[model samples]
Target chain A: MKTKKLINDPKVIIEEMLEGIVAAHPKHVRQVEGAPRAVVALNGPRKGKVGLVIGGGSGHEPTFVGFVGKGLADACPIGNVFASPPPDPIYECAKAASGGAGVLFMYGNYAGDVMNFDMAAEMAGMDEIEVRTVLTTDDIASAPLDQKEKRRGVAGNFFIFKIAGAACDTMKPLDECERLARKANAHTYTMGVCLSPCSLPQTQKYSFELGPDEMEIGMGIHGEPGVAKGPIQTADAVTDAIMDKILGEMKPNKGDKVAVLVNSLGATPLMELYLLNRRVKQRLDQVGVSIHQTWVGNYCTSLEMAGASITLLHLDDELTGLLDHPCDCAMFRAG
Target chain B: MKTKKLINDPKVIIEEMLEGIVAAHPKHVRQVEGAPRAVVALNGPRKGKVGLVIGGGSGHEPTFVGFVGKGLADACPIGNVFASPPPDPIYECAKAASGGAGVLFMYGNYAGDVMNFDMAAEMAGMDEIEVRTVLTTDDIASAPLDQKEKRRGVAGNFFIFKIAGAACDTMKPLDECERLARKANAHTYTMGVCLSPCSLPQTQKYSFELGPDEMEIGMGIHGEPGVAKGPIQTADAVTDAIMDKILGEMKPNKGDKVAVLVNSLGATPLMELYLLNRRVKQRLDQVGVSIHQTWVGNYCTSLEMAGASITLLHLDDELTGLLDHPCDCAMFRAG
Candidate 1:
């Protein structure tokens, strides 16, 4: 069967979606003037406060845009499915989020996002709006333990965005907010597994093929290769496998507190996520890692891809307080 | 490929999921002692307030369980996949939620849930605790206008639950809380379309089949047949088709306000939901209905089902205020 989609013209999907978002959430967001792809907070970037701008490809709903709210990202420039926004919108986002205080640009460390955001930062510099970039590298499977800098960011982007956004709400200086964001990134870890592939609207073809009994561990959000592929395993076995890799790297000692996220990668059901969480909590209990909180739902996705990712954010007293901060956006709000 | 799922035993899925939920959200919820499937709010059902218990089948996560928090449903009983909870758990849920005041049992109006909840209510009545039920029959395609009571509930359950829960927060009496619930259900209307079918874990077989180019309009949450089936259509066309049936029966005059929910049935991407919402907002605009707030995500799902549902709650001042009232839940919160 052909992959079915509800779209008019694939090329204009992003613009149409942006229009819908701003219209549906007029009080929360608006399109940046002359930057159709940039979605800016309607009530953010107040005076004497550092501005936080986040962006990345589309498909990961509530990730880059749903997170932009009163105390989260001030602006998010959207891109095509699994692709990065261009420099123009990214620059416009920096300008919009700039509250006289300098701007901080953050996103998952994809090659396209890094290049385009870097370009946008350069453009913001030309306008005398200083900008700093923090590329999130939390996907443990993307790189070896000794080379964590090369890891790709996955669901852990949510934590980095929240910590930095909360810091900005305190009217913190740009340097301090950037430091908090880096610290958040350093303590975050994520790993994912995909059961099926997601097709693109334009192409109408599946991105990858897996056998009936196969599962791929550490699959990237955009169908990038993972560390291993084998027959599908039980929920407990899968948890152990993924956690083995993450805990090996993160190594949160006993008595440490952490926040856990069991996120669906598009098409996975909540029942499955919760079932997986059952084992996740068991393992955390055995390891003596105290769960400060838990978020289980479809937070970041791959546009109908069938999979899930687990994210762990090891929290200190400071990080816990910052994460508990409240903010309201379109799809997510937390305190 | 076979339908992939992350579960240990299909037989114990509900029990295991409930365990995970209480473990992960100890502050928000707990499993009623000796009634493991009956999940009750840890901090709710306080004295003097009207107790609110809402529940239904499993698979539609964040619907019945996620809504159990402060100012929302005080309890929700777990069921097997796509099946309703038995009377025992439902009865226990009511007893746990009861705090001297009466209990209001609200949920989707399906035969199984109705029968089970009715049995539970009868049991509660034996204890001298008044129990009132507000059955949601809001699916526009399920019945004729004059036979609205015969309709089945779909995504509209969210609005009904929220409004009724908010009313209970006012410490209203049983009759008044039931009145508010009935008012909320009367104003709520929903329509859904499916692009693919969901499979059961035990069977690993698709619930239904659509040709590569086919779609089903007004499909029920559990793969029940819809009002119409045809070749797949564009996003705008689909939205217009769904909205036409909704508006024809609703007949909302100009100057009416509404809360819109563009819900994904498990696997539909958020981009498509937004694309559909663009047309929904446009049609509502042309019809002169003012959108008060919009929600676009996986609110009600069918366990990896690929479809979307649209729900509109025509709101008066009271309902609108109640909807905007603050409530903190596991998956949903509003202020």
Candidate 2:
């Protein structure tokens, strides 16, 4: 498609967006010059509090950036849309957030993010900063629970963030913080269905394609291919398809408590998410999995695709308390 | 071109979306069940506080609904994408929000919104409920300021919301609140450019079209036909063209304080919005217009259109105080 270039240059889009982020949110986040998406806490770290950090591509709002605030990730390094941020930015974020107690790096299971964050951890160690990495591999379709390294991260990353934020608030050591984040990730699973492909700005075209009336199941946020495609179904059916996989993997038994997130992948209206959420709660209720809380909205979107994703996180006492912690931001806040 | 039938029935899209809004913001907003997009104060209005109600279409997140909080609009009556909510719903919103101090009905200047909100005003009057309408007609291309009725409302509706919200919070009477809102709207002006069209759920297709390398200037939120269409160009050139008309109408004098909003039309990424915002600020700086504050993001979106609109609200002491008032919500809290 022929599209107007709204950016001065394709190269500067990421840097400029980071600058605007600093301008718009002076209290919650600050960006270092020449380091795009390398955001840190404006108020430093609270004494006796562990620090939490997360990072990924730039397109998803309220994710790596929007989720940075009290009772959430203390700092988030952002990459360009559909791209992974580099190691230096990640390293800087860790250093800035580390409160003397230590810092935990919680990120999605994407290969690029994993590799870059690992390198940054090594760098942080050289600077006498204790850092640990917690990878979230919650897409059940990507791998079995025993082989979580192969799974792709999805909306369940929110669970990891919530746990890490809460653990850090209690001043857990780096080891404990990483352990809790991993535990949260292991207990969470997510699956998504897309009605349309998300478009890239510079490319000015969709990242992928599917037939009309077709939906892709178990898709990743970066427009990665899905596990299956089939004729469109009712919202209830789609919710069942996603929740079944997530629930099966989590294996919640009777009386088990969980938090559910019904996320819109950009273009889906709020109406469909609610309808799908209602069906999800109904199905879960029948299965005896008690939904302690629910988050339904565009917390994680894939550009403008008409799609939705479902994520379920089995919760424990610590996780539940963390999830209940208050958050404050323009995109999301939970108390 | 063909499109997918994502929902069971196209007609149910709006109803479903509103249900999702209620689910997502249960603590902050509640859907007037069976009433299309009419949401009232979750915690009933504070006694003796004036009420501010505003709304229009569904796709503009936090615009009408997201802005509802302590220092902004109290309720919103939503319509389908780019459509106005009915008079009944708007009236319900007014009735629910109004305290003994009366109500201020702020809205965009679209024909449907204007007509429906006006009707609601008359209905509220019949019930002996004092109500006033502050119509926002900021799109410069739609009409000249001298011909107020000809101007179309756009993103500048936010300025009215801010002013009205503050006025009402201070217990201003119905007429004073309306006067302040209208004054803010009158001092503001806006213009937009569309690189892509927003897809309405029911239509399952884009509302308008642009060739692969083309853009429409002076476009409306509803995909109302623009004043011009031409091949896409550099960000600087596009900014120059759009700001010329908006600034010409509002005519921000040198040394005058003003607030700028560079808004994304749903699908545009934050990276691009910031780039556009940078150019916008640079242009305004060159023109010697002092920017009191600026915000750039998807404040008012049109489905998933990959375009943007700019709004300039001339700031005086009253408007500044209103803009500084604190707000708390999931989307925007510009108090």
Candidate 3:
């Protein structure tokens, strides 16, 4: 089967894409002093503020790099498509984002990211900069309640990063920022449905397979196996099936307030995503769940896969304040 | 051929999508009093500014609708999937955006849009409200230089609308706003390539067809035919092929400053768009063309088509200020 892609060498796409990103927003971001894959904020970084750092694979853009700006991640070490960034760049990001208050490393939890970011933290420690890690485990379908630690992070990373970044903007200590990020991750629940598989540039092969008339729910961002595979269903039915799982795990009360996100997974059109959002709001309204804030569109993606994910971040008073804190980044902004 | 989509009923998708957009952004936009398809900014319209109204087919998501907000378009009348909005919504949009000052009507130059918008303008005139129109013909590949007026608009609509909106924000009169929009359109050039066709929900069939191993350069956003078709090429080569025609039409000289946009037509990933941008800047660098600002993303999309478009807008001092004006909307915002 032939795959559609535009690249000179799939092998060097990371380097090329990073160069383009920095060139596009030189005033907002730049390459970390010496690291090619590590990017840092250019205009504003206050001294003695807890520096926020994020890292992950490159495919889910706007995630790691787009979030690197004022009131968001101070620096981001980018990796190849669907693969964790190298420790060298991660260490460099920590170094560049360092303030007297120290740095916090946050990212979706995967074996590769966990290992590499942990190693990078250790390397940064040798340089006398304190670094903390907050791994997002928000995909409810990835693990049972008793084993939440094993769940993979998905689109829920948006809320976690946003809250953490906003907290950091207040000049809070690194520990407080890390705590808020962990709280955001804990309150967030997400489930994704993949209608089709996405291919990598080098392989020309899909990361996973489904029939022309099938969907897989709870699929990981890297196309890892999901909880279920079923025949194609209507938008309403699909939302019901995925929401049933998310809400069941969340167990929200009638008066609970939640931030809702209906995110597109790569190739899904905005028209379809908007349609799905209508269904999501209808379901939430039926359940008496008050939507505090709603975001819909391509926040997180998996290259060209056709699918979407719904995330609900149950908010308490403190969580609400943290989320409502204003922050402006390349891909996201809130007040 | 069957198409995979996440939608309820094709007939009601337009209504559903509009509802979803407003529900998620009640603070930013709303449905016009009597017109469901005509959306207006929730913020009050000023008394003396030339109200900006834009509209076109619906499938172009943010292009025609998401741009409605402060410092951007005041209203957008939406049509069905890739079809021209009727005179009803267009007229209603003008009426809703009217603030005693005349309204400025601008949109892509499609036969349907032209005819319908003209009808709407005539209806508004009957009510004693002044309206002027500017049709964007930025797609350099759609027609030869001799037939420039026949060219279709693509991603260049972003620049045209941004500048026009900034002009309207500054309380420019209708004639001045119209002139600025026309100038922006004239200074903009765009070229697109299509690797696959997107389907309309009503018809679960691909809008057009191409070989699995081929792509069409200069294809219209609505799957209209282009100037050439060929096998898939490297990102550099594809960028070169498209830029050659654009630069030839633009004839940009050394030291000329411009805004560059590498837009995903639909399914192309950020990774690919960035790679393409790298090539675009390289080519421009070779010719001493300086990029004033750059954007890379899915600015204007065609459902889920698998390709991208590149737009270059030559900028003078005035145009640069207009582009730099801050505007916050559902899908776009800049400073």
Candidate 4:
């Protein structure tokens, strides 16, 4: 395989990306000095609003950082591509986004992020800035359904963040915000597949290998191997496979209202995502599940992997209203 | 080269992509029916505001479509892959964005886009909706300064869009908006290097080819051959080469206020863009052009090419103010 020189050094790449992100959305987000890698909401400390902070890696453009604004994550502690931010940066971000009301550390269920955010939450607690953690364990394929707590987080995170952030945006108490976030997590399920592997910029080699016609199903976003491998199939076939697994695990009842998210895993085109969404919608309709809203695009990506994921979120009146809430961020808007 | 099967047939790709774009930023942007390929501002009829519309190809995600909102292009017409949109889409977009006020079509100076946009302008005139066209011809290498009108546009287009969009947002006259956009095009210059080729989904083959260690300098966003190709070098050297050419042609004076944009040609990493930005800032500073603002990211792209471009826009008071103007778009915001 051929390799191209990377555009920047790894150390300061996320910081510079943050600079561009802040400049692009100055009114919505701001960068913290001591925590240059962290981006916080410009109108944060909404004076009694529960602040929600989320972050993981940087290369996932628009993930933790781009979503930092009203109706979303309050601040993001960006690390290197697919790497967790150090504990110090995470702590500072928690402090910065925290109002007198307290802060929620909502991060993907990755070991690195979990450990660092836990450390940061502990540190924030010492500073009298109340802190809590709500890990998104929505990737059902990542673990057994009986042990959902061990599932990895995936694009379904956007759903959790949206509902949780909306509650906070409306000045929900810290406990209420955390409760809503957990509830959202419980109802959400995501499963991903990958056709290509990501190359670490410094290494310039695939982190994992895949046969040309082979794809990994139930894969994590970071190019990690999945629970199963299968021959590449049609968009509908792939969508059916993912939907069957997710719905079977989620076990949505007939007539249940849910939101569907067909997330492009990095390099999948919109045409493919929509095709997959169509299949997913059709399958759900046949099963008597009503999709209240649907999002088809690249939300959670894994570098340049040409694949997609399906995330289903069961919704109630409050959750549905929160999901429909308006947002203004550089990369996404829920309304 | 090997080919992989994507999820969908080519027939309905653009339609689905547009739908996803609208769903992604529903409040800020939506699709116009007759203009099936156009994404227009959701906030219609801004009373006295001048409307700005810009577009060309489809694969340059976030460039034409992502820029449609307040303080930016009011609408965008998307073509397939690197192709230019037909006149009908552009005309429908211009009509939708126009609110009795005149409209400015600020598109990159590519033959297809220019021809179609001109046709759209003529159609708009027939409808009595005043319209003007401002072509961005910032690729100095594409044409000699004496023949600037023939130059092709590249990454410097962001400058024209920002400045002209801000003026329009302020309800500036159509003539004023066009003049500012033209001025921005004159002061701006860009040079790009492509480390790899990007493939069209339909073709499933690279638009063009490049060697493992060869980089194309002065490359257009489309797959057109670059001005020159050379042995790949260090990030600093590559950045210096691109910046020297752009700055020398721009002839930025000492202490000249300027804005710098380091654009990724798609697959380039954030780290690489920052490294290139570092070298570009140092080179420009050595030449006495102080960077008043710096933007580094994937703004205008060429599919998934692994490369980056450097853009320098000489900023006067008006240009700087425009650069500083407030914007609220799906992908970019500036204030």
Top candidate by lDDT: 1
**Per-residue lDDT of A1-335 in model 1, one digit per residue for the tens?**
56998888998999998878887899989998888889899887788788999989998997889999898999999988889999999999999999888999999998999999999999999999999999999999898888977889899998889999999987889999999999999999999999999999889899899888899999999989999999998887888998888788788899999999999999999888988888889989989998999999888899999989999999999999899998877667888
- Across residues B1-335, which tens digit of lDDT does each residue of candidate 4 receive? 44444456667777756655555456678788766788888763477788888899877766777788888888888898778999999999888888788998887888888889998899999999899888888887677778989888888888888898888888888888888888888889888888877777787777777877788887777767777888877777787777768776777778888888888776665546656766766686687777686776668877667788888888899889888998888666666
10 residues in a row with least lDDT, candidate 3 chain A: A326-335
lDDT of 3 at A320: 96
Give the worst 10-residue stretch by lDDT in candidate 1 chain B.
Answer: B1-10
TM-score of chain A of 1: 0.98
lDDT for B70 (candidate 3): 90
Off by over 4 Å in 2: A1-5, A33-37, A46-48, A199-205, A251-258, A269-275, A281-296, A304-306, A328-334, B33-37, B253-256, B287-293, B329-331
Off by over 4 Å in 3: none
Best-fitting candidate, scored by TM-score: 1
Q: What is the interface RMSD of candidate 2, in Å?
A: 3.2
Candidate 2 local lDDT, A32-93, one digit each (tens): 55565688766536766778888898777657787787767777788878778889888888
* All candidates: TM-score of chain A: 0.98, 0.94, 0.97, 0.96
The numbered model that scores best in DockQ is 1
**TM-score of candidate 3 relative to the true fold:** 0.98
RMSD of model 1 against the true structure: 1.2
The C-alpha TM-scores of every prediction are 0.98, 0.90, 0.98, 0.83
Ranked by lDDT, the better of candidates 1 and 4 is 1
Candidate 3 clashes between residue pairs 3 or more apart in a chain or in different chains: none
Give per-candidate clash totals: 0, 9, 0, 7
Under CAPRI classification, how is model 4 graded? Answer: incorrect
